[model samples]
Target chain A: MAVSDEQARDELGERLRKFVGRPAAVAGAGKDPVNAPMIRHWCEALGDTHPAYTGPDAIAPPTMLQVWTMGGLSGHPGRTGAYEELLGLLDAAGCTAVVATDCEQEYPRPLRPGDEVTFDTVIEEVSGRKTTRLGTGYFITTRTEVRVAGEPAGVHRFRVLKYAPAPHRPHEPRQQRRGPELHEPRRHQEPESRRRQEPAPSKPLRPRPVINRDNAGFWQGVAERRLLIQRCTACGTLRHPWLPGCNACGGLGWDTVEASGEGTVYSYVVVHHPPAPGFDPPYAVALVELAEGVRMVGNVVGVPYDEVRIGLPVRAGFRRVDEELTLPVFQALSSVTAVER
Target chain B: MRAGERLEPLEIPVTRTLIVAGAIASRDYQDVHHDPELARRKGAPDVFMNILTTNGLVGRYVTDHFGPKAVLRKVAIRLGAPNYPGDTMVLTGTVEEVDGDTAVVRVVGANGLGDHVTGTVTVTVPGANPEATP
Candidate 1:
């Protein structure tokens, strides 16, 4: 006699319970010691210029805690059979698809260059079978304790759902599979009647800047075709993308200084996919370091996206994208122009 | 930091290079973050940003406002809309509470689809008090 589905679920839940508190990984070591190269790569990729993440006494970005613990493409040597066995059971039970749900991390101490990293993970919990938008599945959570030279540094809690695909409607197209099950469907779907009443526009306007009180003056400057950098009244320090208080001296009083429009491409990335409104694909967005010693983000004009490079001299210019929008852009200066400068 | 104080918004263009670069940099070799064809097979319209990269971006947004002296103590986030390449994610923050040197900031990153990430970050900024300044 075949067991009832409810009985099968209960049996599976019981087996899953035993897996909890079991070691997922034992004494896993980082593939590489925390070093400048990896930190630099992370910084460049994220466009993070925090001085704390660099220099002789640099501490790794706190968010980098998990990066050091990842097993990478080759996988980690310390992973135990119990974790795999648990996953195999779930797969055999028809919960094959997986999606990371959420993560929680705490950094007790900062990671620094040359720190030897090691970690151990344990299966913290496995939830009972449940139904979600994706399908019926279980949520498996693991907690990892990361250390530097035998001292506690951080803790990471990662959770993922192993679910079988939800049943599709018979008439629905099979190729019309949904995006990542983790993300919600678009929030601004138009009503079918309204959408039919007025056809959608051909091109989308550029996303408007969120002009709040702190940055309103900067946008005002842009309207006047001036790139303004904030100057601290007390410390005379210059800051870009204006903030409420001075970071250098924590001063509240500040004024604006018009940029000289001279800068260099500190870093850049070429956008290629998913297609935003009002812009063509394969364009360069650069972090331009102004001569005033502050970096600002803008589009790189007068050059192909691929040609934009670090340290390339550029001049700031304003582009009126629409009636109410004027943006600061950078014009890459040719070698001849750089020589003239 | 005072409660209800808002941080300036930061706009980040989601680019394919950023997606691939961030995945590799964070040691997350997920194919959906790089291989578009594979991503399509997995039902994603195109390659999308990984959660690690989103976490890094959120961390940077907070630190950039608090300056180099600031340190992040905790960051807990939940993903929503996918950050596909060629889109934009605008990160906004509000200081929800403050005690001594540590402040809890509520950060929301919204893309074309909607809120991509919503979470709170605990950051400690040395000498963050504006009133104490002369």
Candidate 2:
């Protein structure tokens, strides 16, 4: 199966070009998965023991090489996953581009564990930014195909978007623009001129687990079904939990309040199997944007064991994971997805 | 002066330049961490920092502060930015919260522009004497 830009748009951002074109050759593809830990993890996680993944000998995990299989960086000092190229494509084109917004993956065939993978990627569609009261955003769809021993293993679909000038209604007032102050320089330029010219070089949050303060309030609210975000009073930026100051504006004071919990499926993954101890398979991890402009990553639950779709309208439901922690899980508002593919 | 009291900014600050080798030590090879080509390609603006350096830097910050007596138990890092070569980052931690033998530190690093790493750290000494009792 092959995909192109036009084909992807028709399928609502499916079929990427990078993953197109089979090697046109295959050999000993079915006998590889006998002895691989990564593959075994996938099998245990998905609980899928297809023959290709569990033949005579053990094979690597189907998604085992994900960490090791990052392909060559095709540009200047590549970051992770050709991220620069992806972001650059959007930064130059879209006013505000976000990454990993709507990510979906599925396996058409099983990959043997020991079989080496040849990954290819393609672009599907680049949607214009959609505006909200906070700012405008857009979507970029990509397709990736994973091959082992030149055989199809799985397909990955990703949708990235960034909102600039947030997609507000035409009737919305200019003062209520979703983007930073109009007086500021170009979105990309403002940061370059600032002291923290680049996103603060990721330093260790600490030598140990320092609380992600930004999510403190959200975590605190997790105990309550009241999902809350830190709203900066100075610049009106909506941030999750609390931080010393705003990422957008250097504000110290913040107000924590409940989130509407009504949001679309921004990004999601079907964890075929558990990654650690005490985790069950057939669960979903998703990033949902509540009505209040902030995005939260939590488990997406309650759909039929299968059938979790993109753009699904979901609401927040909290489950206590620890005495002081309540995890946020999303259940479908209705069986129907907001914008069915 | 009380032990572990906040140190004021000395007029003449103590600074050292650490030359970190770029050889692969950990299993982590995220391209941006070691490969300059991969890093520049990924849109990092530049290679700025990694979890490993941050780990070492935190030890340096505390070792310098505690003079070998401040026992360190925990240091956590959630990588936010990429650390590249020829970059010197400053590690700074503040005693944000202090409890009975335990102290919670709010730590961050900067290349002078602003913070690159941000997180809290908790360190305990062998025998921490408190100022007041319960």
Top lDDT hit: 1
lDDT of 2 at A240: 59
Q: Estimate the lDDT of model 2.
A: 0.44
Candidate DockQ scores, in order = 0.21, 0.01
Of candidate 1 chain B, the 10-residue stretch with the lowest lDDT total is: B37-46
The residue-by-residue lDDT of candidate 2 on B1-134, one tens digit each, is 23345633211111211212211221223443554443333334343333433443443354456443454444543333233344445566677666666676655555433344555555654456556454
For candidate 2, write residues A1-341 as lDDT tens digits. 11221122332112222322322112212222334554444344323344444556543332332222332222112122343333432232222223233334444443443555556555566554343322334555556566766766665554544433221123333344434322111222111232233344332211221357555565545544457778888898988546778899898888876776678778788877545543545667778878887887877654543566778887775543322334566756543211111
**lDDT against the true structure, each candidate:** 0.78, 0.44
- Mark the regions of model 2 whose C-alpha exceeds 4 Å error after superposition: A1-341, B1-4, B7-23, B77-82, B130-132
Report residue A293 deviation for candidate 1 (angstroms).
73
Chain A TM per candidate, in order of listing: 0.49, 0.35
- Candidate 2 displacement at residue A176 in angstroms: 14
Instruction: Please give the distance, in angstroms, between residue A79's alpha carbon in candidate 1 and its true position after superposition.
Output: 1.1
Error of 2 at A37 (Å): 27
Using DockQ as the measure, which candidate wins? 1
* Cα error of candidate 2 at position A118, Å: 30
